[model samples]
Target: MKKILLSFFLLTFFQNVVAQTNLYENPNFDELAKTHKIIAIVPFKTQVQLRPKQMKDMSAEQLNRVEKSEGESIQTAMYSWFLKRKKRGDLQNLEIQDPRTTTAMLKKQTIDYNNIMDFTPQELAKILEVDAVISGEFETNKPMSEGASVALGVLFGFFGSTNSATINMSVHNATDGILLWNYNKKVSGSIGSNTEDLINVLMRKSSRRLAYTKNSKDKD
Candidate 1:
């Protein structure tokens, strides 16, 4: 009985550690976030690392298209997550800029996925007319939105074990481009196989630490 109890405790501890996010919050995040009424979520910079056989079958253009699509899909999923939270009154007094408007403004500034990294967060905030911006990068071994493979993984609970993804997200204050918060996480298995599921998992863990959420300022 003692051995079984010890084993269960260890399993619970391991799960807690694996589920936690690597989060960084600026010392002045509360002060900075107080002025942040509106924010924009941008397309994540995405890189898809293909196996040799897959690489050989795809052209350079096709690879770029896949990366771009994945980036936009993540951005959209993030927006949906925030929208749902806002509707639930968890994100009080905060407004998220529509992604369509954000994209149009970026295009008006001649910024595309390839060149967006050239601009600083403050520059993007000015262009988008938001108080802050949410941006990130995603690296993955496979296309996350591949419905068939992901669905199969959901059903069988093993196919996603072969896939891996790393996400690093940050919030920057528009005034000075100082990073207010950052979250870095690595995800695998069935939960990381699709954009919606991935963002849902990530944001659920991150929302407690996010500056804009209700009562979040008091959390570590």
Candidate 2:
């Protein structure tokens, strides 16, 4: 009976993991880059599947409390790393809006955190007046590795290795009001895997890509 229950539980867990959608990412980033200069890093918007270790710390009753506790801090840290990258690269005429300020502004409109896009920072920029908007969701899913390459010690406690959370990024230009770029990245932990390395790496990558190109200025 115990084995049956365990199998049932694991099956239910995998079912939900399979249901996680790949189609959620919008391919049209270029179109989103119109009319804003503030790239606002908001909270993790995904309900990511958990590795065994995370599940150990939280009972079903404590599930909601545990995930919410980490989302805000992680988002802030990731945004900070992004700012550092921009400064390092000497990207001029670029402005990053404070994550906290954006969050507060959204709250004023009675918009829930998940509905951030509907408010569309570009429109807000015209009100507050900014050049561009950058925003994305960082979701962490702890995926375990398969087979005997794994250690027995973890099986006694955990299931296997994890893929960590992939960071999904989107850039929007406030002037034209269109999305510029979007992609999923298995990051090192500016936000997920409980480390800082990934965030810095992501920031650097984004900074280079987001740099105001000479060609773009030529058009202006």
Candidate 3:
């Protein structure tokens, strides 16, 4: 019985790892990032996929609001991660624009959650007066900020419930509008998963390959 249970656990863990893996880095990332002293992190485009029962009480507008809120939550989380790294001297002379400033600038330009995707990354960078822009998309079945209860399957049933989230993060250069790096991953959230924890896990996995990391630049 013990062996059978351990095997099942290992199999489930392996599946989770395989499901949450993807990364890309432009060949010329070093060159493109050379002049990028500052970068702005825009609100991530977010989508919440709720089951029928979950959506029964929510209107379309309410759903949209939830998505917008989630997007901003992710944006703030990402900024916090960068700020922490910068304070730790893990970043390579990089300046992360505050999300409040970024949002204010976008609003001044008549841009909002509904239409922010209409503009190109380069355009956003120019408007925000930054050398590069960090943007991404997040999709989940539940609100991350609220730490909703979710269940994975029997595999997780043994432990507890879990939520699933798919995240895509990318960096774009302002000069030529070229993608410098991209990361996509699917994560299984344990109970009490929130934006900050999600961002911490996501960033920790990608920090080693991030072009702006001090260690990455040192390799050049």
lDDT of 3 by residue, 93-113 (tens): 779999999999999999988
Candidate 2 residue 209 Cα shift, in angstroms, is: 2.4
- For every model shown, what is its TM-score relative to the native structure? 0.81, 0.56, 0.82
lDDT of 1 by residue, 1-220 (tens): 9999989865754354344358899989977777779999999999888777666876787777778888988889899888877887767888999999999999999998888999999999999999999999998786776642443234334533445678899999998999999999976654544688678767765777787873643211
Looking at model 3, which ten-residue stretch has the lowest summed lDDT?
Answer: 150-159
Assess candidate 2 and give its TM-score to the true structure. 0.56
Candidate 2: lDDT over CA atoms?
0.49
Residue 167, candidate 1: how far off, in angstroms? Answer: 0.4
Q: Which residue runs does candidate 2 get wrong by more than 4 Å?
A: 1-38, 51-62, 117-129, 142-163, 187-195, 203-206, 212-220
Every candidate's CA RMSD: 5.9, 12.8, 6.4
**CA lDDT of each prediction against the hidden true structure:** 0.79, 0.49, 0.78
Residue 196 local lDDT, model 3 = 86
| By TM-score: ranked, best first | 3, 1, 2
